[model samples]
Target: MVNIFDNKEYLSFFCFIFFSLFFCVFMLFLSSLLGGKSLSRYKHTPFESGIAPVGDTHLHFSVKFYLVAMFFVIFDMEALYLYVWSVSIVETGWTGFIEAFIFILFLLLSLFYLVRIKALNWTHK
Candidate 1:
């Protein structure tokens, strides 16, 4: 059995890490020493596109747009998971295929519900 604790290579690796960390901390300290700040009301105020901010940040958004975005994200994630499972289908055999099929069926059912609720309709007028 080899004694890993007795290895010179491991000691040298740790020494390198320690020196790197020390150098990083020293540089940060030097930078902070060079930089100075002055606080003011204008500095604290929120900046927006080089123009003064007007309206409230907590403004209401369209529910339909959010719903459509959520639907897209859910379906996109499902496709990504399906792709990962497809690569290992041979190893997983019929069980994986059945599981993936059921997953797709559930997603389709959800999509059907969304369609019924007019969630996909972009024209609100």
Candidate 2:
């Protein structure tokens, strides 16, 4: 029986790990030596594209933006599920078809609910 510990493959693997660790530590030390400490007030301040920031950064945003973003995410997820089903449709046959139809129905129902609640209406104040 051949001993695995005496194998060249095992020695090479350990050498690769040791060299990777050594290189990473050397690079980190070199970068720290070259980089200077940040002392300027402007460097610490929140930069808004060189424009002086007005009012609070945590001010309330439009609800319409959030609503639109949520709608986009829901629809995007539906598309992804449909794409996955499409690739395996031949293998799953009728069952896959029914499942995809049900998924789309639920998506449509959610859209209807959003419309009824005036969530889709951006014009309303």
The candidate that wins on TM-score is 2
What stretches of model 2 exceed 4 Å from their correct place? Answer: 1-35, 46-60
**Angstrom error at residue 73, model 2:** 0.5
Indicate the TM-score of model 2: 0.62
lDDT of each residue in 23-83, candidate 1, tens digit only: 9999999988988877887878887799987777897778987887888899999989899
Winning model by lDDT:
2
Q: At residue 75, what lDDT does model 2 achieve? A: 95
TM per candidate:
0.59, 0.62
Q: Candidate 2 — number of clashing residue pairs?
A: 0
In each prediction, how many residue pairs overlap at the backbone (N, C-alpha, C within less than 3 A)? 0, 0
Return the lDDT, model 2, position 105: 96
